[model samples]
Target: MTPQQRARFFDAAAVLFDLDGVLTPTAEIHMRAWSELFTAELARHGVQQQYTDEDYFRYVDGRPRYDGVQAVLQSRGIDLPYGDPSDAAGAETVCGLGNRKNAVFGETLEREGIAPYPGSLAVVDRLGMIGIPAAVVSSSKNARQVLEAAHLLDRFPVIVDGVVAADEGIAGKPAPDLFLTAAERLGVAPSHAIVVEDAVSGVAAGAAGGFALVVGVDRGVGAAALTDAGADVVVSDLAELLPAEAEKDGS
Candidate 1:
């Protein structure tokens, strides 16, 4: 979309955001952790082909942890039991591998910390200035920790994350349940709200929810792919979505 077109598009009553790649750079952290865990596990299983960043986009990105593990394994024609969430990291089950990945992610996050993407932060600040409510809706169970670590926890009043989804038995993205739940919590209809996401599955979720707008943030994921996934518009960065007048007003 053109700058003006994006500006008008985001003049929404509420905006639901996917936390990692959309608002922050933790997607890199997640990619790294997934690579580490899958590399080790695949090697242990004598799977010669490597797990690359491409796999993350294709199988893991934007989905719940266990679901991601299942998706990636399925790609290799590998199947494991879907163990309970409390399964140990070494249990050799889907949930176990997901938990192991989460462990690696948590350690990396604590050691290196995280920060919101500058462009995303700018757009969010501007939206706040205009009194448009925004909520964080992410597939990560660590969404709260990531937000709190970035000192952005208070900026978003509602968070619908993997933990909440699990507790509520809501299916993860590429389903609309989580986003729709957030919209309902915000007292806004899907048709009046916008969803900002940087993952294809997330864009699909937003589109499935029948939201007023589905904005795809291109952060490694191609703009064309995002558009194909049902994004109404795609921007190189959220900063591009900020209005010129808002930018002039210190946005």
Candidate 2:
């Protein structure tokens, strides 16, 4: 990265990151779990349409679990009651389907452990060296578990995730509450902190929160889409934010 590009991050008071695609490859696991749940649910309901990756980016990715379930179900014109969070996995309700997906995710995670992306870890290390605090702001209830599995839980001192959002009545992404809350917890102003995310909804939340910088990591989502969603800058990996010399030194 150029000195100017690196300065954008080094000048920030703090950095807030989306846990899944940004820090770890768990987004792939999430996509698989969502596909498994929706494919079976659609098949059982005799729905003519099939679940696709497009559906994930459009309705599921980056949102709270039950909200994603509700959005996808609405697309298929299937209206299930918004069941209680404690509902059984197979129950015919929104929260039930979400819990079912979470079950699959847990099994997969346990069967095969996860690791943080090398590039993301590089950025985190660089940020820590520069004395900039960092936090995780994710829409997933499993954010803590994923971080622990990846051995990244200690890197982020503050995490604002789905459980906290639910308990505090904070709205999810595309509403700015999650990112704003993270900045607040970090004792940083929105205009002084940066948000790094791979999901369009997350980029929108950072933008809506008026953060200093909104960086979109294009794991799979197109650059154009992230730009349209309000990312101030877009890169394929977090390592690109570091100076070329710094990356080599870290290596």
Candidate 3:
């Protein structure tokens, strides 16, 4: 979309966001963790699928923990038992592998911490100036903790994260339930709200949810990929979309 087109989309309604890649710069951490766990485990099975940075964003990012496990596992042509949530980490169960990945993700976050996208924040500030209420929709149970670490918790009062998704029996991204729930919580119709994401799965999910705008923040995946995944607009940085309010209002 052109710059004017994107601005118009934001002007139409409240915004809903995915936390990890769009707001907080933690998507790379998740990619690293997935690569570590999947590479190590796949090596044990004599499989040689080299997990790379490119693969992470394309296949697994923006999905729930267990869904990520499934994506990586399917990539390796391996099918493990869908074990119970209590399955031990590093075992041959969906939950176990997912839990193991989470351990790695947590360790990485502890050391590297979180960072925010100045450009995205700029657009957000403008939206606020115009009275557009934004909510967060993420598949990570640690969404709140990460936002707090980044000192951005004050920006969003309504969050639908993994905990809420699980408790509400809502499926993860690409299913539209989670995004839909966030729009409902914000009292905005899906057709009148915008969803900003940095994952292919997330862009697809936002589109599936019938959001008025599905924007892709391309930190890694090329703009073409994001576009193919259903991003009505793809941008290298959110800064390009910021209007004057966020640039010089000093808010």
Q: What is the C-alpha local distance difference test score of each model?
A: 0.91, 0.94, 0.83
Q: Which scores better on lDDT, 1 or 3?
A: 1
lDDT of 3 by residue, 176-211 (tens): 888899888888799999888888888889888888
Report the C-alpha lDDT of model 2 over 110-140, residue by residue, as the tens digit.
9999999999998898888888999999999
Question: What number of clashing residue pairs does each candidate have, in the order they appear?
Answer: 0, 0, 0
**TM-scores of all candidate predictions against the true structure:** 0.97, 0.98, 0.92
Worst 10 residues of 3 by lDDT: 242-251
* Candidates 1 and 2 compared by TM-score, better number: 2
Q: List, residue by residue over 1-251, the lDDT tens digit for candidate 1.
A: 58666666567889999999989999999999999999998888888888999999999999999989999888877878999999999999999999999999999999999988888898888788779999999999999999999999999989999999999999999999999999999999999999999999999999999999999999998999899999988988888787777667767
Winning model by lDDT: 2
Instruction: Output the lDDT of residue 174, model 3.
Output: 81
Question: By TM-score, highest first, what's the ranking?
Answer: 2, 1, 3
Ranking by lDDT: 2, 1, 3
RMSD (CA, Å), each prediction: 1.1, 0.9, 1.9
